[model samples]
Target: MSELLAPALSGAAAGLGVAMPMGAMSVLLLQEAVRERRPAVAAAAGIAAVDLGYAALATALGPWVAAHVTPAEAWIRLAASAILLTIATRGLLPTRPAPPPTNASPGAGASAGPATELGTEPGPSAGAGPGPGPGSGANAGPSAGPSAGAGAGAGRTFARYVGLTAVNPTTALYFAALTTAQGAALRAGAAGAAFVTGVALASLLWQQALVALGALAGSRISPAARTWTFRLGYGLVAAYAVKIAFPLP
Candidate 1:
């Protein structure tokens, strides 16, 4: 019992240590939450799932992974940087044209502006309530209809986060180092399972907290503020990409 408890606690700490850091991944996750387009819960689950997978792999093949992966760290970092840069660029670009001003004549077709340039679902209008009408931003168009909703499903968001988080070489290396140091404790029967469970739970909890924070922020801010927030978030992501591409001494 004590054996299991100790390893589990250690694993939880390790998971939090890795997940709590603010990186490109964190910025994107916050942006997702703020936009309230894709499901944040799904994104959180995806991140935790990737963390769990990496942690398990590291625990199982710590020595082998440490040997091979270390040699490819530079390449992996470069690839991750490239991917992050692409995402940031897409975010910075406008997905669709902005709608005509509110004072436009009745004959004018109001082009629905993208909620944010994240290339996901449309957002509700400023101060709009929960239904369909002129004010129902997301629900106002065929664009946000069944097909769009399906595309924005939890699975897609989950897969997106999994890919985003999995590309970080640091996650794999961090878990590998921990596993190498505590291989014995982490490997001992039920203790190993407990430890992995602890890691998953901690990672999930932290991610969910971020989602909640972003959602709260999304609710309070005006639409323009949300757009600026996304721009800032993506800008930070781009900065991270540059840093990863060429780390300072």
Candidate 2:
């Protein structure tokens, strides 16, 4: 039992070490949440689900994968690195120019204009000019307003999240290596299982916490800030890819 306990602990530690880092998935989740709100949660959930599946596979078939999947590790890392670079570049690109401001202000240069005169029948009163109506202003339209479109936007966000995760070869390789490394401990039976379970649970717990924190922060950040955050996050993910591709060892 004591011997088994060590492996399980080791397995759990390995799981935490690999999963705890704020990698591409983490950055993607944060950006999605901040940009699309509710959809961000769905995207994060999907990523976590994938991680759980990978971890389980690593524990269950560590040996088989290690023996047969010789080129799998290399392939996955290359793919992940490519995707990260693309996403980072997209984020860094300049956004489309904002629409020019309209000159619809009441009586900007009109002589004796009733539109600007106070207490006039055709014009707005002193305090009531061409102000925005209820739920219809510069910040209250379909493009920026809160409406059903938000839900649709969430779906789009989820799709992007799926794309990012699916293309990440590094994640697959990481899992494979992890499982291979912990094989002996896992085969040791119940104790090994317990350790794997502990590690998996810890990873899930930490990732969920990050998702929640990201969602909360997203709610408060401005649109511009969110955009910059997305860029920075993707840039970091790309940096990680470079490191993985050219490790010191």
Give the C-alpha miss distance for residue 94 in model 1, angstroms. 1.6
lDDT values for all models:
0.76, 0.58
* Total clashes in model 1, counting residue pairs 3 or more apart in sequence or in different chains: 0
Error of model 1, residue 1, in angstroms: 2.0
Number of the top candidate by lDDT?
1
Which numbered prediction scores highest in TM-score against the true structure?
1
TM-score of each: 0.81, 0.61
lDDT of 1 by residue, 50-135 (tens): 98998888878887888888888888899999999988887777523444456655454334334333333344544232211122
Error of 1 at 85 (Å): 0.5
Please report, as a residue range, the 10-residue window in candidate 1 with the lowest summed lDDT: 127-136
Q: Residue-wise lDDT of candidate 2 within 1-249, one digit each (tens)?
A: 676667656656766776677777777666554443466565765665565566666677766655655556566667667777776666555332334336656566356465334422221112121211111122433356555655665566556666666565555557678767655656555854675666666666666677688768866865456555656776777787786665322
TM match of model 2 to true structure: 0.61
What TM-score does model 1 achieve against the real structure? Answer: 0.81
What's the C-alpha lDDT at position 74 in model 2?
65
